[model samples]
Every structure is written in structure tokens, then in C-alpha cells.
Target chain A: MESMEADILIVGGGAAGFACALEAAERGATVLVLEKQPETGGSSAMSGGCLAFAGTEMQREQGIEDSAELLANDLKQLGGTDADPALIAAFATHQLETYDWLKAHGQVFSPALEASSGQSVPRVHTVDPADMVRLLAARCRTTGKVTLLVETAARRLQHDPAAHRVTGVLAEGRDGPIDIRARNGVVLASGGFSRNPDLVRQFAPDCEHAVFVGGAGNVGDGLRMAWALGADLRDMAQIKGTFGKHPTDELNNHSCLCVYKGAIAVNQDGRRFVDESLSYKLLGAACLRQPYGAAFQILDEPILRSGDNEVRILDFERRLEEGLFIQADTLEGLARQIEVPEEMLTKTVADYNAYVDSGEDREFGRKHLVHNHGALRRIETAPFYAYPSTAAVYGTYCGLRVDPAMHVIDVFGERIEGLLAAGEVVGGFHGNAYMTGSALGKALVFGRIAARTALGAAAG
Target chain B: MQVVVLLAGVVDPKWRLDRLGLRPGTELADESGLPRRLSPFDEAALETALKLRDADPAVRVTAVLPGDVGSDALLRGVAAFRPDRAFRFDTSGLAPWDPRAAVRLLGLAVGAACGCPDLVLMGREFGDCDDGVLPAALAEAQGWRFCGLAHAVAIADGRFVAHRIRGPREELLRLPPPALVSITNDRGNRLRHPLMKNVMLAKRGPVEVVTPQAGAIPRAVVARSLAVVPPPQRGAGACRILSGPVDAQVAELAAYLRARRQAAAP
Candidate 1:
């Protein structure tokens, strides 16, 4: 029956948790990060490493002009009216400053600006998420005020019903059970419930069939704990998977996103299905509704070569090296190699190529390569390639609801006292549709805000 | 009974090998930036020791890490498993390639951590570079009975019993205390996730870091070498699959290989 106390107890040592700990410790608060996994870095480490930030230095250097207003408009348009306008506005306002904040705290980003699933312009800045988490965790350790506890999972939030406050936590450790008193407040940055099949089945049943690709530690512990406190949840039914995950290749975390770079998606009947130009999250939903929930990314040689080998989802050449791509001299041969009907695939490609030549996607009307940019190309080449692709639940993208100040809101429409949240565990930022890189972005922006609020600082 | 497990392993082997780089001016690998985690066998040995601790009320599991001392992030990283006592026998921040050198250093480290431990457990290969060298060399140096490739180790009749896979069958052997056993990963002996509460508490105090005096180097007969192996060139040609039954496909594959081998028998 060991017990300890800290000024702040941050559950889940993920991108959000680590960022919160660093911010709180810098402000001279004793912060403790409890992670259930053997190591930290949650799903953030396994992500595609893209962060959506408007008006970034990388964007300007790359000669692409972007603004917060435009970025906010894209998110709202893509996410529909379901997304919290207040939260999206807050994110737009702080997105640029957060990018600078991360850089000021030893975070580095690649200069290359690449287009991802949903973006009007190239703004997805990349980083080695694992290295970034390691760097942040290293900084947290150096603070002498932050204690990181991996292999320690928070079981439940200790709520003082009379005081209407979450005072502490009941957690299980390496040895046995222990209680921790969060003197100031407890922050839940425990990530999403994508890894928990039961929770996924309960909330977003459509995602149940998607390959569960998420942080092993994310099993809805924070979600359940918050639910026990009557915390209102948001966007639960909107959990959509990331498209183009190699149906059988579970080892690699990143999915192949050739569809975003002018590749077409074909269903089991060797016919094109949904418009692949939409957000990948939307594509995942459309893909699942197809036959057997499986499809293939059919592209030309130029499109195959357009892949950036460094980034995971963008690295089509790596997948080619790994033998994930079925290459053939003719589309018929590729269709046969992938065990699909040759005639149907050949005709499908011919019609698509004709449409590409005519400058219009007649049937699906896929105008842009991704979202609304990058012109589509004709799939006419000697050596055609086809990759069997499906969808995977990368992150739940839904969880407890929180306010702009990062306070967890209850079902009664009141803020839960001494309870704050950040990361994938606190959702509603991405409503019905998810734009790539925004999950990590939201985690960072809200993580700092949560720390500032918990430390009694004015919400910046 | 005090049991000591070697809690060291190779860098996560799952990393894309294309990312690996070799240091210039030295044959050493540039794995300092790589993510290092407990190997499967390392977890197995640690799990086996925990099982022993559970089976016997008096048994205590201690960990002896014979690698980096400066890597407090990694050092305290493994200590979260909540061993009874754990410490590092500081090396040059890397495990030496010499088998005998690793043995001498590990022997001193074991002695320093737990005086005359009843059993010493280690992975089948320490960092893959050791290749069962550490356990064999240590047992030889200490003159203790050695057992290698044991998937499961248990205490029975006051003796250490090990069930090992030999060829296609399982073999069991029993040895007296003060035994050194090299363990391989087993389905049942996976390391359990440590509770979050204990992980925080276990790493509170400073990890006992000791720098053992360098042992005498043996007469050198071994010189290690390193080379990058290029992948075999795969012919970029049409792959034709024999559309038939399984037996027919196997026969065709066998005939093709036989014909190719005979044609190349120059």
C-alpha cells in the first residue's frame, strides 16, 4: 500500500503527456507521467510523423503560402458541422505559435513540405516521432521535477464526489497497487481506444473490421476512467480508419498512401470504388463498404516513382522493395497476379486513363490528387503496379470532451473540477472526417494549454 | 535463494536494416541513435527468474546489467520491472566482442550484485553478438554446471530443472544450485507488464552503478571483422505461378530447383 503525491499527475506518457509534463515542470510544478506500456511514445511514435501547421517556416521556404484562416476553413469543411467551432478556432490561432514553441524546445522538423490526405496546400511538416518523443522525454527527465513511470497504468480516477473534484488516481504498478495524489490536478493524455476492440465495437463498430493499428498501451483506460466520472464524450461514432494499410503487412505502422499521389483504388471486382481524392479517413470508410472490405492501389510507373522513400506512407518505393507491390508489364498481368479478373481490371484502367486524358473523373469526379490539389495523371505505362490495400484503425480520434482551457466537461454540461485532458483521449477536434497530422497537432496544442491551466497560469 | 538475470539485449531487431549505419574509422556499429529494447530471450530469462521467485517464497530476483552506465534513461528503463535489486557493471558503454572478456566482467558483476547467487539466468544470445558466449564462458570460468537453450527452467527437489528442445524432442536436465543457464524465449515465459505504480516507485532511488576494475586481457587470437552484405539480386522477370493442386505445385517447384542446380554444377 505505497502512496506518493505530486503537483500534477499526467496519465499516459505519450506525445501529449510528455509535452504536458515538460510544460508543467518548466513552470516549477512537480509532474508525474504514468504510462501503462513498457515504454513511452504511445501512438505518436507509430504515426506517419506529419503535423498540420499553418504559416510555418517550412511552408514559406517551400514557396507554399498558407494561413490560419484557410487552414481553419479546410478543417471545418472537411470535418463538417460536427466539429467544435470553438476548438477548431482555438487550434487555428495557436497552431503557428505551437509550431514555434515545439522548435524552441529542441524539436526539429524536416524542410520538405508534402501533401497528405486532406489539405488545400502542402502544410504537413514531418519529424521522426520516435526521436521527438525520446528528445522530449530526455528533456522531462532533466527537469528534475517530472517523474516518468512506464509499466504503470492508471486504473481509475479518484473522484471526491462531495467536492466534485478528481483528487488523485488508483493505479497498478510493477509490484502492486498504489495511489497517487495529484495535488493540483490530473491530466488524461492516455490516447485513443483504437487498440481496444471491445471499446471500438461499442463506439465505432465500423472501425471494428479495420486492422487495429494503434499504441498497445491505448486500451481506453483514460476513456473509461473519465466515463466513470460522467465525462461527456464526443465524436465517438466518427472513428474512421486510415486507408491504404497493406491488408497483411501488420509489421509496418505506416500505411501506403499512394492514393493521395494520383493512384486509383479498385475494389474486389477490379473496378474503381469511391473517389480516392477525399481524405484518407473518409476513404477508409468508403473502402470498408466495398466488397470484403479490400481494394488495391493501381498506379502508373511515374506515380510509383513519385513516392518519397523517406516518409512511411509516402514511401511507395520501400514497399516495392518489400515485394508488397505486384508489378507487371500489362494491367491484365497485374490483375492476374493479384488474383483479380484480368478483363475487368484492364477495362477499368482504360476508362480511368481515358477520363484522366479528358481532364475529368466522369464517374467518381475525383478532380484533385488529394483534397483539392495535385493534378491527376493517366495510368498508362509499360510496367504497371498494383498494391493490395485496406484500412486500419490508426487512432480512435474520439474520446472525452474538453473545453478550450483543457478542462474535461461532464455530461451535465459542467466542467469537471481538477480534471483536465489532452491528446487523442480528448476528442471533438476532428469530427466526422480526420485530416492527417492534426491528431498530433491537437495533442501538442492542448497539452500545453492543459499544463498552463493546471498550473494556475492564464490560458494562453 | 537469490537469482540474477542478465537484463541486456540487442537493439530492436525490427528496425529497418537500411537505416543502420557503421561508424567510420572503427568496425563498431553506430547504434547509439537506435531504439534499444529487451530482446525476446532477455524477457524470457527475466520472466523465468520471476517465475522462480513466485514458486519459492524465499527466492529474490536481481538484475545485473553489464553495459552502459551513462544511459540512465535505459538503465532505469529496465529497472521498472521491479527486480529485488538491480545494478549496472559499467563497461565502455558497449559490450565487448571478446567472449572471455564478457564472462570475466559478468562474473565480477554477478558477485558484486548478489553474493554467490543460487542460479544465474541469461538470454540464449547476449545482444546477438555474444552468441551464447557469455553464459558458456561464465560457467566455464566459475566452474559451475551449464545448461543452454532451455525454454523453461524450474526448481524441483531442491535442484534446477530445465526443459530444453533437442532436435525434434524435448529434453529435461537437473543440476545442483550455483548453476548458469542460458534461456530462449518460450510462449509461456513472456515478461508481464509491470504495474505503473511500481514502475514509478522502483526508479525513485539512484540505480547502483559500479565501475568494476578492468580484468586482464587474454592472449589475443581473435580479431573481429565487419562487412555490409548486399542483398542477392532478384531477377526482374515475370513470376509465373503453376495453377494446380498443392502437390503438383510442390513437384514443379522441386523439379525447377533440381534442374537449376544441375545446370549450374560447373
Candidate 2:
């Protein structure tokens, strides 16, 4: 096999791989990023492009007070006891610095702050995810030390039995098979297995029938490669799907999260099924148990007007233009169009409005729009709207277990030498429930940490 | 029964082409960095062939793709379907923009790489270049019966019956062996997901690469240049958000909607 060498060899060129490469290259280390697809930007590019950060300029500019400590507390409270405290702490520690690093590297974020899923305050730093990946990839190229090889898929890790270290990777390139050696370390940033049906069925079997969306190249290559070496896995059973995906929507891949802005989700029976204030992932679980795994997001004119086109999940106008939402002058008409009982829907709306007026949700105990943010708004204005919704597995949030330093750990609680992982490939960040922007945030923060940890060890 | 399905993968529609141009001093459009996927039409054609094979154990389906090395992965994806035989022919210096020449070259590749196929299948548009002409032209050149925009195909009474939508109604046409049918995507012919085991096997297995028998064909059409341009915007008019009390706004909105509906009435 043909052979090549670099100071750092990274697999999968999504946000994590690119971030790792840029960090390593800037620190005077030569890096090689292997992207299996013809193009870069894996699932990170396919995401809604929201990044979770605390105490940023955007948050302050929007007059929203947020801090790393509050962010950490909210994550713990939302994720519950299952989340690894160390990883959560690491994210909270480096989130602000990573945000600044991204900005300094030409990443642009919209000035709007959104509170979704697990946030006490609005801190979702949104950007064009595909543009961010392209920007980072370009920065890596300008360093003159990182070689991004597209259409090159890493087949297996080359391990040294005596040293007990992962030396490099055996990959299949466009021309033929090649063996690449990493002098410092090998980082697995191959993202999640959202597109791999078998892996999805094996882990998140409950979400098997849910719609699948994400990068075409995300087939759990890194997870399988690390697992072959007996790496411990975490949060595999906690894989959850995002609610509000239209079952037949071919134009848009992202979900429409109207519930986060004060819309109620109702089942075919025209009755509220779950508290809309819960994270969309939890809502997705509840939705799947309903008849036909389907629900409708009921919103009013004011809620529809609250959509921000800059945010992917909140871009309700675009979804409306695509004819994904049913608009009716009256609630009865909406019920007729969606084939639900008019009386039950009317009663449901009346009850919800009463809860909104009384400042208490008697059923499901919902107070905020999402998590602990946004005041509840009564959906009384017309014309009303109903968005047909289903759950979609955006990314598998469970994978090989790793320390906060990003070193792959064995099932026996030993760190595998010279092996590191980041991004969706390494789990333990989100335990029981998913935060809206944390996946991309974890990719950026942990990716930089992995690079620093690897280079620091090499220097020592 | 033997069938040959022509698979011409298109550049993934999801990708925003930041830069696209013709290769210097050549008519070939440079698509070096763009991602490609099996288009709906290609999937429809392949699935129709697979459905036929599923109904009859005697049927042998072979998938043939004509492209350079970049399309090898696409061939492997096709191979995951476990066709009787799947292969890719060299299209190093050929451009499919010239429909007449493409038909001749494709005919040669099919005849040489895959044996004489009892029935030929392809999408309405061959690759991203052809605009629904190559299949019919190829069939005419080979002197075989032709059907276009077929949604599904089946065997009945030792002949192929093709179903297609034409204008307002669905049309069913029957033809004997040695025929060509161009397929259009439909719910009935949606491509089935490949098994993970077969996907892994195809990844490890060696892909059969065939060198097409080259012969000069006179070109009737040639692409001089190509450039990526933004699609024309169809103005639906700007959105007007209403302002006032909830009751007044609803009344005004109702009036506007009623007026618009009246204007739309025949």
C-alpha cells in the first residue's frame, strides 16, 4: 500500500475535523483530514447551524444575560443525572473561547438569540453551518500545513500491538488503497450514524420508523473503528429524534420547531399530547407513541409572524411558502382540512388559552414556550395554521465513550493510547435530552481540545 | 429475460454550485469538486428493472454506468442492489452534451460491455446534460421500439408493458423484446434501501471496469461553453403583514382573501 505521514491524521472532515485541523496547523503541526465524500462538511453542514455559547457579544447585544455557569447548570438540569459532569464542565469552560476563535477565523453568526430545548436564557449563536465549515476548511488550507484529502475513506485504524497505540489509518482513496501514518495522534471525527439504518435499528430502535436526515457520509465509521478496538460506548440508549419533521417534505431537511415560539402540538385526536415546553427530542418521543407517529403544530398569526428567516428551525414563512402548513380562516376549517374533530380542537384551543390567561398549565404543566424561556402566548388570532409534523433522527447523539480531554477510553476504563475522538462520534455530553445547539458546539469545543491535548502530549 | 439499465448519476441538487465552468479548451463541464447522487429519474429506472427481476426469477438485470473514475462509487452503490452484473465504462474524453454522439458511444459501450440486452432502460434525461433526448435517439439508432417517461414496466405474455403519464391521463403501451423504455420517477418505483451487508460487500468487492470499444461518431451538437447562473426568480410579490386590532386585522385579511379568490374564479 502507498504510504504517507503527517503530524496529525483526522478522519471525517465535518466541523470537528476542520476545527481540529485548523488548531493543529496553527500550532505548527502538519495535519491530514480524510473526507470520504467528494465534498467536505458532513452532518455539521446539514445541521440547523445553531451553536450553544454563553456570555457572548451577540447575547449581550441582544440584552440577554447569560453566563457559562448558568449554561452548565441548565445543561445538567435538562440532561438530568445521566450526563457526564466532566464533559459538561469542559464544554462550559471552553465554549466562550471557542466562540471567539470561530469569529476570529471569519465565522459569522446572526445577532439574534434563540432559547430552545435546554436553555434558561437565549444563547443560540446561529450561522450558516455549511458556510462555517467552508470557512474553517479554507483557513486550514491557508495554513499550508493541512492536507484535506476528499474522496478518501479511512477503512481501519493501524494499531501498534507492542506500544498499544493507534499509529495511523488504512484508507481507500480515489486512486487506490493507502496507509497514512500520524506521528502525533489519530482523531476520529467521523460524526454520527444517522444514515446507517442497521446501526439506528440496533441502538435507537424506537426511532426506526422516524424520518432520517443528516449527512450522506455519516455511517458511524468512527464509532465502528473505535468499537473494534474495544472502546466503551456512552448514551447509546439515549438516542432521541427531533420533532416537527414533515413526513413527506422533500425540499427542506431541517425540522420546523414552532412549539419553541408558543405553538401547541396536537395529535390526530385534536388534543394536546405532551407539554410543548419540553425539548423537541422529548416531544418527538411522545409523538411517536401517538397514532401513526404524527402530530400537528397549531399556531396563530402572531406566532407565524414571530418566525425569523435567519434561523433555520424558525423559518416558518419558507415552510409556508413550500405549502407545508395548512392555513384556514377558522379553527373549524383547519380541523376539517387536517381531518381532526372540530369540537375537540376547539375545546383544546379554549383550554390552552385559559391556561395562558391563568398563567398556569393545568395539563402537562407547561409554563414557558421552550425549556425555561419565553412567556406563553395565547393562540387566538386568525387565520390559524396547522403544520403536519413527525419526528426525524437528525444525528445519533451516542457513540464511543471519551474523557473530557477527548482521549478514547476502553470499556475497562483505560484511555486508548494515541487515539482521540470528537464531534458526534464521542458521546457523554448530552445524556438524557438534547439541547438545540449543543451538538455543533460540542464539535467545535471538543475538537479544539482534542487537538491541544494531542499536541501537548506529543510535546511532553 | 435480460435487461440493461443505464445509470447516469447527476450532480446532487442540494449542492450550491459556487463555481462552474467549462474546462479550458474543452467542452466538458468541470464538475471536479461537486457531489453527485443517483437522481430520482435514475432511481426510478433502476427500481423498475429491480421490480421486474423481483417478479421473475428468470430475469437477469445488469446495470451499466458510463463515466470516469468519479462514478465508481455510484457503480458500487448500484452493485449493492445485487444486479446480475454491474460495470462502468470509460468516458474519459467524451461529453454527453452532444446527444447524437452520446447515443452512438453509449450504444457501443452497452453492446460491448454488456451482451445484447433483450430490453434497455434509462432515465428520461441521460445524466445532467441531456434534456430528454438521448434514450429515444439511441433506440431509434439501434432500430428498437421506444417508450418515454414510463413510470413502471412489467412482463406480460412474453412482452414488456410500460405505463406512462402523458398530459392528462396514464397510457399503457406494450412492446416485445429488444426495446427501450425511458423512466420517470413515481411513488410506485421508489428505490428500495440496500441492505447493510450488501453495502459492505460492495465496498470491499472489486468493481468491474470495462474499456468501451472506441469508434468515431459524427457529432450533431456540441457545447461551446457553459456557466453556472442563478435560477430566474418567480415573483410571488412581497409579503404584507397586517397591523391593527386582532378583530380588524382578521376582517381586513378576510376581505383581501375573498377578493383574491374572486379574481381567481373562472
lDDT of 2 at A223: 96
- Of the native A-B interface contacts, what share survives in model 2? 0.00
Q: Specify the CAPRI tier of model 2.
A: incorrect
Q: Say which candidate scores most in lDDT.
A: 2
Q: Give the TM-score of candidate 2.
A: 0.66
Question: What are the candidates' individual DockQ scores?
Answer: 0.01, 0.02
Candidate 2, A152-237: lDDT as tens digits: 99999999877778999999999999999999999999999999999999999899658899999999999999899989999999
The TM-scores, one per candidate, come to 0.64, 0.66
Q: Which 10 successive residues of model 2 chain A have the least lDDT summed?
A: A244-253
For model 2 chain B, the run of ten residues with the poorest summed lDDT = B192-201
lDDT of every predicted structure (CA atoms): 0.83, 0.89
Model 2 deviation from native, Cα RMSD in Å: 16.8
lDDT tens per residue, model 2, B1-266: 88999889988888887767887777777877776778888999999998899789799998988888888888888998889999997787678877778898889767854567888999988888887889999999998899999999999998999999989999999999889999999877877655333555788899888776565656777778787667676568656678743335768999989999999999
Cα lDDT tens digits, model 1, A1-460, are: 8898999999998889988899899999999899888778999998888899999888887789899998899899888877998889988988899899889888988767888877999888888998888878888889999987778889989999998999999999999998999988999999998877788889887765578888888899999999999999999888887898877554677789888888899987889998998989889998888766778899989999998876778889888876678788998878765667999999998898898899988899999899877898888976998887778888988889999888999999898899999999987889889887899898888898899899883232
